[model samples]
Target chain A: MQTLSFQFSAGQPAQGRALVGCVGSGDLEVMLEPGTSGTLAIEVVTSVNGSDARWQQLFQRMFSEQQMPALNISIHDFGATPGVVRLRLEQAMEALADD
Target chain B: MNDRLDQTRQQHYQAHDLLWGFAPEHLPLNAPAWVVEALQVEPPVVVRRAQGTAGTIAVGVRGKTRDQRFACWMPRSAVSHSVQPEQLIEPGLAQAHRDWPLFKALALLAEPLDQSGLRWGVTGSLGFQLASGIEVIHPASDLDLLLRTPQPISREQAKAWLELIAQAPARVDVQLQCPAGAVALAEWATSRSQVLLKTQVEPLLVDDPWAVEHVAP
Candidate 1:
């Protein structure tokens, strides 16, 4: 598995934690938890190895585009397509927002 | 013989007898032969559904490629054993209550369903992790559930149940198992014209849950 971490300084910390999706075939799960630090941290563990650059680019694009708060977002991936990953991330964030 | 077998058709089996297998179509490994070899080396795939016939039963297998699910007929004689989902989950939940805070929380959240008289079982990563002692669950794993009900669930009732689960720390995916078939609570909540119902025979997009039936091959 490949692990990647990122930090963003866009939005304020979310009120609570939330999660979405399951780590199954062509799918990925995302978890957003309250972060003690002021930074928004994202850590992705994926089965697809040697695609660090591609993943980094994707994460950069997502974080840059979205107004995510200061929370720790962790993803467990099982070779999910980019579309699925993005949907899960958005759902997780939406859940967190609702919380 | 048909009557006796019909009685056993949809009956749930104990977890010890069941051997989880991967679907031939989705087997990720390049070598299909290796999977066949592994099946010989591993336990024989057990029957998931007893179709009340001489040759076959609906067998459960996971997709190798994507998270697609597969349940199809296989010769009953080929199965070495059967497994119960409830048996695998209850022990794990009990153990987790003593140690894991997250699981403890989930247990508490699930209490209402038990009180509601719904037969429920956990099935996703948490279930797999607890049953196999595998490290599948992370800090953020969703509490996937299977709820068995003898009768159809109303849309309003489904929403109410979902509201109860939404209070949990993690997201919950509940599949309501009615006599006709099992449908995801989330999908059912949409109140769509048709919902995907997974039955012992096969999955179908059915509007009326009661009218759906699984015919043995």
Candidate 2:
């Protein structure tokens, strides 16, 4: 498995933790926890290699403009496509927003 | 030509079916090294679902590991041999590797699965191996199954099947084949609202997969 790290600038820290998705074929599991002030840290452990740039592009597309709360996100990915990754990320963001 | 495959008159290929006789030099110009090598190894490429193009069908090449799968399009006319999960069911049970978790689980579930009366069979790694004798299954490889459920099954029925599947030595992933598309048995049994429906074009989140009308492209 390959582990990728990405950090994004953010707003205030989130209050509660949220988990979404699963480590299944063509899917992923994302866990969200409140992190240090003004920084969103993400670690992705993925089964697919040579996907660092794809993840980078996806994250940029997702979080480029929107300022989400500071959270530490850990994703356990099992060869999910970018579409699936985006879907799970959106779900995680929604869950965090609900809390 | 021993290609008496049980397919529709339209020759609609479903995901996870294995197809042979593709031109290896037919990949996109920028195809990766591993993909080229894997195709040269001459394994039957697994059929994949994607938006339909005029003459090309979507397929994936398995490169010995879960991480080594590559999705690409193949010319439909290039398919010399095709094998579906239905045809592999017998061979999967007849294979002598019951000591392996995947085969063992298949053996354990065969009777009950037959009794359930669901048009079910093997797919994924185990099915690939059984069909081609290429040895794609490992000890931890999941037993992927497809239950052709044109009629929507009750959540209770899905739960019951889940319980039965849980008894197997291997992890079983059963995709319920609705008229529209497919959904995971675990999700359909447990989800309160929408579940993911994997269609040929894309995955759709629908309350009832069977209720959705499949639109052919």
* Per-model DockQ against the true two-chain complex: 0.04, 0.48
Q: On residues B61-178, what C-alpha lDDT tens digit does candidate 2 reach at each position?
A: 8887777887888888888989889887884345566688878788888888788787887888888888888877777889889888988799999999889888899998888888
* True-structure RMSD, every candidate: 10.7, 4.1
In candidate 2, which residue pairs clash?
A: none
Question: Fraction of true inter-chain Cα contacts (below 8 Å) kept per model?
Answer: 0.00, 0.30
TM-score of chain B of 2: 0.90
Q: Locate the minimum summed-lDDT window of 10 residues in model 1 chain B.
A: B62-71
Candidates' TM-scores?
Answer: 0.52, 0.90
The i-RMS of candidate 1 is: 7.8
Instruction: Name the candidate that leads on TM-score.
Output: 2
Q: For residues A1-99, what per-residue lDDT tens digits would candidate 1 score against the true structure?
A: 678887777566678887666533345668888875568888988877666777777888888876666888888987655655766677676666666
- The lDDT values for all models are 0.60, 0.80
